[model samples]
Target: MYSSIYTESKEMYDELKEWRRELHKTPELGLELPQTVSFVKNKLTELGIPFETKVNGNCIVGYLGSGERCLLLRADMDGLPMFEESQLSYASQNGNMHACGHDIHTTALLGAAKLLKKHEQDLKGKIKLLFQPGEETFEGARAVIKEGILENPKVDAAFAVHVASTLPVKTIAYGTLTATSVFGFKITITGKGTHGAMPQNGIDPINVGVTIYQALQELIARECAPSKEVSLTIGQFNSGTMNNVIPETAVLQGTLRTFDSETKQYLITRIKEIVKNISKAFRAESKIEVLTDIPVLCCDEKRNEEIVKALNLMNAELKIISGLHTTGSDDFAVYANEVPASYFMIGAKENSNTIYAHHNPKVCFNEQVLPIAAAVYACTALDWK
Candidate 1:
């Protein structure tokens, strides 16, 4: 099982963990990952692996084996824009940090690439190593797709692994479908500026903003079904600078998340109606715009079952979770739309009490999961077809 694979390549696995720690120390954000890109490219070069860099500026793609059946393995190369708080010796140098465990992801994929290269002659098909950037902002996967990563090799099936804090270490959580869809909206209300002391001189956008916010709550409560998972949160708001002066314009930004397409559309339409009606009531003009849209992630059940069987054969503890309709979203859905895709969770928590959630400054992953994850990546790819 997995132990044989680990014992056969113990040295390589240890090296991968070291690389992961190093990456954790020097983290980069978004598509601007020069150091990380160079590190990956140099390692590939030393191993005599062929790769293409900067497909979308910092996104790297490496190919191994030459068989007809091809599989794609992806890892996010970007870090979050947060300060480090961990006391590890290899703490982040700059303000940025690997709070989301992208470092571990990159290292695991690299390890898989190396091991797969050693067994290239035995491989039944080609393997595409995808080192993506800007996953924190959900832009990297789309950027890689735009660069033709899937077109050149033509991915038949794809797999991506993410380390989880909630799951126990060395355990695997496989979901048939992942609930992650995020939609952003910006609302601007225009009104006349006037002094607070004025009794009835001009329309106040602050009052209109408050009314709109309250109405938004009512819209969700009355319109959306409680059974359907949905969330709408206003994350940012801006208005007047002084207490006495009423600002002429007020801006509000928020995000909407849902697993149902019809519910998503209904929420968007209702949002527009609420903004319009609330503005009209206060004699103000309002405009609403959708900044971004991420579709819900749906997995191919057959492919997922295949992956689960493979991992179980590897002696990895398995758990089948009833897919949840969640508020968080991922761009991985974009790739799933085109092909059979499986997104698996690798446990990184040392224990229940010590685990920290993603995007938190104090978040850190158990590095030991790197080798297990790497092995899973290779085994899953080999299991395909």
Candidate 2:
């Protein structure tokens, strides 16, 4: 039933692999993706798809078909700030890496654009291709939304796919509750600096920071219900610069993840209270600020069911796995919140050896999954009612 889609996607496999590797080699970070944008623009131009570049960020929206009703397929174009350790021939020489598989997502969307263009005459409605930037930091989807990517013809639904290294290649994972929402925070503890030996003369902000960090553990452990999934992780702690000198300030950077909005608010309130009270107890001053907030990703049940049914009718050899969810957060949640959206996970695990998790320095995945993802994107756009 999906033979033509496979053949077209497979025909572009070599090209898709090259695109992914090139993107992987020259990974860009955040919204300012000049090289990456240029590459995608060149590809879009070659495919003859007309696109408009957003003025705010490096967001590119391309158009295909001439119908009225529309569907959108999005692919993130930015890489993480971490260094690459994949050791592939095309490994990034720069510090940045596509550890989150945005490279594959971009390449797959490019291939999908190619496939969809090949069958444009058969498409009943229009398809919008969004190549967005800065999913790692700022919510690029929000930027895309602000720029009105969902307008013009007006998209009826939106869909995107993320690559997972742990799942075997050719497996499609779906979930009702797709991904957890996150709140990233930076807390600073301030106190007077003095000689390291004269502990009694000045307040110790590091000690206060430690106390606040310890108290934060109870936010999820004791405060949140046992059945609820909430995680509080402190990723960075910075304090004294020298061994002997007491630092005047200590900064703690962390993220809070949860599926419940009320729980998210509770965690933030408790964190502020804990930091303030803990610092006051130690004769220190403190400040807590939210750096980023990503809403939980929830799929439209009806749209997801329809997409699953469409996938089942396809002839692709991939395994279709449903009812899957992840603790990780995605800025795509921004779009899912705004419109009827369905986000799926594509398995890219190549071997049974060592599966590296996403955002890891040595993260890697099977390139063969690229065509499958592209096909799914193209078919979803082509077959959706």
Candidate 3:
């Protein structure tokens, strides 16, 4: 049955590629993916797979088969907030790009929907096809959970696969603690505004912001152990509008990523401490607002072994690799928290040249992994007990 799925997906490769390219052209951003959602719903309807919209019509949940034992297969369809630099014929022109290969995730899951529905009667229980939105903003999974994507049939376990543009085609990578937890925050520094020529007139928040940024960087290098994976990055910084006049407020937004809970808490505490004390020292007031707080994604060891064994027996030459870790984070941790779960990365490296990591404007993934991931998704569901 597993080998048969591989053959079926291979035969649908062209359709999968067409779907991927169609999605690649108009990569929607954040939670408000109307067009993308409609496209998916239409496709699901065409496949005769029933679905319902949640998260204010953003999150999509499609179903196949029946029984109390349900397995959820999830895929995110959001695009990054960047313009595409790749000169492909179907490159995104809407100023948003799917540089993270989420387009492939959605397409592969769609392919899986077709495959699973084709073999719906063969499923041991139920299959919940989770078409998640706003994964880039880290809101999709939580939204779906709040709207009860985990309930209804009540999922027993969940599985998701992300495409890795850097890994060679057909390579499947999986392991524990695959993604780091993230604490996204925005810091605002308020100070007195004054003319540029008056040195003693006002406090400069930009100056304070620069100092705080430098200190936060040192917090990672000096405070955290070298063996620990801790990354504190300031992705956005904004201040005054005029060059000559000092602005009243300066804002700094960044994210803290770590694999250790204790370390994450400690660093978060230290970040607040640093922001508070440093701004005060500069005679400025500061405030910290959390934008997103997601837990680390750790796959179940026993579940991982089971899935690996099944996938391997399904396709011996599948090139499955284990013991891999990534600094990048995903909201899939929300699902992993609720049930026994496992995740894997399918390789999509297209060439031997220099590789472009995810979120880059120039990044493009190999489409060959499209059907392979689709088959993997279908096989996982069909074989799950």
Per-model TM against the reference:
0.91, 0.97, 0.99
Error of 1 at 110 (Å): 1.0
For residue 385, what is the lDDT in candidate 1?
Answer: 64
Q: lDDT scores for all predictions? A: 0.81, 0.88, 0.92
Candidate 2's displacement at residue 154, Å, is: 1.9
Cα lDDT tens digits for candidate 3, 22-100: 9999999899999899989999999998899998898899999988799999999999878899888999999999999
Q: What is candidate 2's lDDT per residue for 53-167, written digit by digit as tens?
A: 9846388899988776888899999998888888888999888999989999999999999988888887878888999998998568777788788789888889999999988
Task: Provide the clash count, candidate 2.
Answer: 0
- Pairs that collide in candidate 3 are none
Stretches > 4 Å off in candidate 2: 55-57
Q: Is candidate 1 or candidate 2 better by TM-score?
A: 2
Q: Candidate 2 — what's its lDDT?
A: 0.88
* Global Cα RMSD, each model: 2.4, 1.3, 0.9
Ranking by lDDT: 3, 2, 1
Q: In model 3, how many backbone clashes occur?
A: 0
Best model number under TM-score? 3
lDDT of 1 by residue, 187-301 (tens): 9999998888993888888888888888887877888889887888997889999988888999998888888889889889889988998899889999998877878888788
